[model samples]
Target: MAATIIDVARRAGLSTATVSRALRGLPNVSESARARVQQAAEELSYTVSPIASQLSSGRTGAVGVVLPFVNRWFFGQVVSGIDSVLRANDMDLLLYNLGDTRVHERFFERMPVRRRVDALIVLTLPLSEDETRALSSLAVPVAVLGEPTPPFWNVRIDNSVAAATAVRHLVNLGHRRIGLITGAAHDPRRFATPILRRDAYRTALEAAGIRYDPRLEAMGHFGIEEGAAAMAQLLTLPEPPTAVFAESDEMAFGALRTLRRMRLRCPEDVSVIGFDDHETAHLMDLTTIAQPVVEQGALLARLVLKALAGSHEEPSDTVLPTRLVVRGTTGVARRDAAPGVPPSPGAATDNGTGARGARSPVP
Candidate 1:
């Protein structure tokens, strides 16, 4: 029979509580006691029964991670990061894909999380204050990841900063007529992240003395099809934008495809920038803003662990920073004259100052 904690405690000549503390590496257990407990466990071929440990100790040894969408690269990468740490801590992960409103509503309403897992982690769950309160009433630890659905432990990157970086990159590249494409704001409860991003983009433009052009901004679904369509729409304008900043790399990839179809060469006729530095972004030589998605996951794991231990009570919204990544997609505005167009300008130099002029002919 596999040795149990009782067997190890007996061999170590210590109480079962001390042996448990030593095995869990709790600070109260002395070093000598810990060493003896370890040796005794090895001699007895002892292994912990996670199920029994939870039953007796009142912990499930498992955590439930709820994400609105797992198919997206950003959420998948964050979940992968969370899994890495939880596995090391001997915790099992149960994933809940609550992408659909109907499914999520039913799940939250049923409140099935009671006693099923020690803690919960939500990734951009599209939750309101009332829904968050309902989940908290489950009386277990909860950690939120990405786009804060607050009154819970949170780990997220600043969406506004991310948006600003993309716009600034285009502005600094001598592209004054810059367009922004992001998730649709038509649905408030659905696409909150994109709305925050658009706010940041507008703020950056305003700071640079650029008049926010409604024509230069469009709503897009968070996928390739919308990305392509958004780009095509921007290009079709009579005074087409010289640059495009997409809220996501996947969307930018779609835009790139659109540019190819129209024979519009990058950095010659237009410039492009995207966020999330996805692997494909590098393959396509796209400029972007890189943030640590996986690191956010690791933080979520730690937060959940704290919650399970009843140690994390105060909710927090943490914002990670971002940096600009220059690539082959952006450059000085190219002079493409229309028929009978008056040309009195040379190459528009950026001097690294973003958005020096808006709604004016390129210098």
Candidate 2:
């Protein structure tokens, strides 16, 4: 029913191969031939088949986007960005969501993407040695959106610096007793974010001459319920922290909900800060570190496309900027100090240097 390459070639008075090359804008096709092929195609209302194009070019014209969880906010935003670019470039996206250890292991073992996609964009998915080897052996160009992994094009923010900046914000607010709620370190898909944040929290305290109190730390598993539970446990401690920091906006929301249930006035009783300037963070009035989550996805997708087009070479990582965003949730330490000890002295100032700071689930 539709015109094929043969029809276009005959109509344009050129060979089929010439017509194909001309339509695709491949080298060696003269401008006159390309124009003739275009005119013929338009006259016949003909469109090239994507499958046939791939077969001829030896390219899938598709990208494999691998993420640990797609339903999470960060991943969803990232996916949206990637999808936008892929769509504009006339390419398809084959998403791979490794929601559990079994699924993750199976995907890596099979490495099916090698045969189905032209390039890969891995979003904060940590790889074991074997997995890394498998990915490298796939011979597909890979782009990562997280911490830098050698031999792969990457886009990321410095987690350590971002976390330190967050903690420093609280410190500048005259809060000496700071507590942290972090994700579980032992999770199968665990990456360096939580660990790096936790370490930076301690480092921030040390820099301010505050003692590192292990009792002030709680593991929230990066969930709302877990954050609430962790906050509840912290509240039960002998001397609760004056301020708390959740590693993600979701966790911070959970912590804030728990504080409300306990009739604790934010900033007046316990100042709370979180990472990721999630859309809801403003609604919650949460003070947080904002990272360009969606932009990272867009950048990685661009790199993937470039590599697939045989344009990107000399592997390099793109480190994005981050910034602290102060809001109503965080403030100066409560004035109700102990009988003798004075509250740490500092004005409550938003320390966001307009520089920057998730891999939290979306829902």
Candidate 3:
């Protein structure tokens, strides 16, 4: 008979499970046990039967992609990057959505993905202690794309630094009355990035001798509509901001839309800045921080692939860098010696960040 896992186990003097694990190069087996298994398999002229192996293995020859909201710009682009890598690797991707708690809980808690995918790539949502705890016990390997995941492979960026850098760009341009338009997420006690970026905004403003003005800030969700909503609210105030730094390109684009609708020009009426140098940013000529999103995807994908190959060592955490890409969206603060404009003040605070969320199923 052609070689089978049972035959290999019988010849190696080990249990079928041990022999199976040895063939996959999984670590728990001792070196001596592996050697014996290898030798026996050779003697039996054993070659794994693909069909039989599939019947015995739980893996479905697929990778799980966990993401938050797929409709947003950054998440969508990052997904595109991951898809490219997975396609080249000859693997299929399974997608899941976690835009809300119900959707997130139903899938993650039920653990339907168990045995369905060989590995998982988490994009954004910061798993709570309970969620993180459950994920750690999963049977399959995991690779995180956005934030640094413990006891697993991951890649990310420094959010505090990125926000500081973007804010600093405006500070350098002499924008004292620079306003930060974040979203519902800005209230860290309630959401994620809002607080981090707000802190970075504060730090940069304080360094530039400005007082933090709560009145100058507005909040919205992670969408273009929210950006427009925030901008419209900011416009009617007695003292409109001279410059604005949005946390994402979607918001920035929304700001752009509001500005256009109001017949106000960017950098001229008010300078606008955004995060994530997405393709739309280039099209809109938005000045912003360019994160290595696609490259991050490649790195995250490689980590998942390594786990699939049973070569995963200790868990790894990687942090990538960001750069400023100047475009038409931002310019010198309106206070330029022009005939008609007033001066402005600033605010201050310290802060943080994370990256490594991926495409496929994560947010």
Query: Considering every candidate listed, which one attains the maximal lDDT?
Result: 2
Candidate 1 steric clashes: 0
RMSD of each: 6.7, 6.8, 10.6
**Which digits, one per residue and each the tens of the lDDT, describe model 2 over residues 73-143?**
77898999899999999889999999988999999888879878899989888888888788899898899
Query: Against the true structure, whose TM-score is highest?
Result: 2
TM-score of each: 0.78, 0.85, 0.76
Q: Estimate the lDDT of model 3.
A: 0.76
Q: Which of the two candidates, 2 or 3, achieves a greater TM-score against the reference?
A: 2
The lDDT for every candidate, in the order shown, is 0.78, 0.84, 0.76
The lDDT of model 1 is 0.78
In model 2, which runs have C-alpha deviations exceeding 4 angstroms?
A: 3-44, 339-363
Q: Count the backbone clashes (under 3 Å) in each candidate.
A: 0, 10, 26
Q: Worst 10-residue stretch by lDDT in candidate 2? A: 354-363
What is the Cα root-mean-square deviation between model 3 and the actual structure?
10.6
lDDT string, candidate 1, 1-363, tens digits: 788888899899999999988887668988999999999998998876667667867778888888877788888999899899999998999888876778788888886777888888888767777788888887877888767675788887888878887888777765677888887566645666788888898998898877888998876666778898998889777777888889888888888888777656675566788888987778888888888889899998988787666673687888888888888887766544442121223333333355332322111
Poorly placed runs, candidate 3 (over 4 Å) = 1-53, 186-191, 336-363
Clashing pairs in 2: 71-362, 72-361, 72-362, 73-361, 73-362, 322-355, 322-356, 322-357, 323-356, 323-357
Preferred candidate (lDDT higher): 2 or 3 = 2
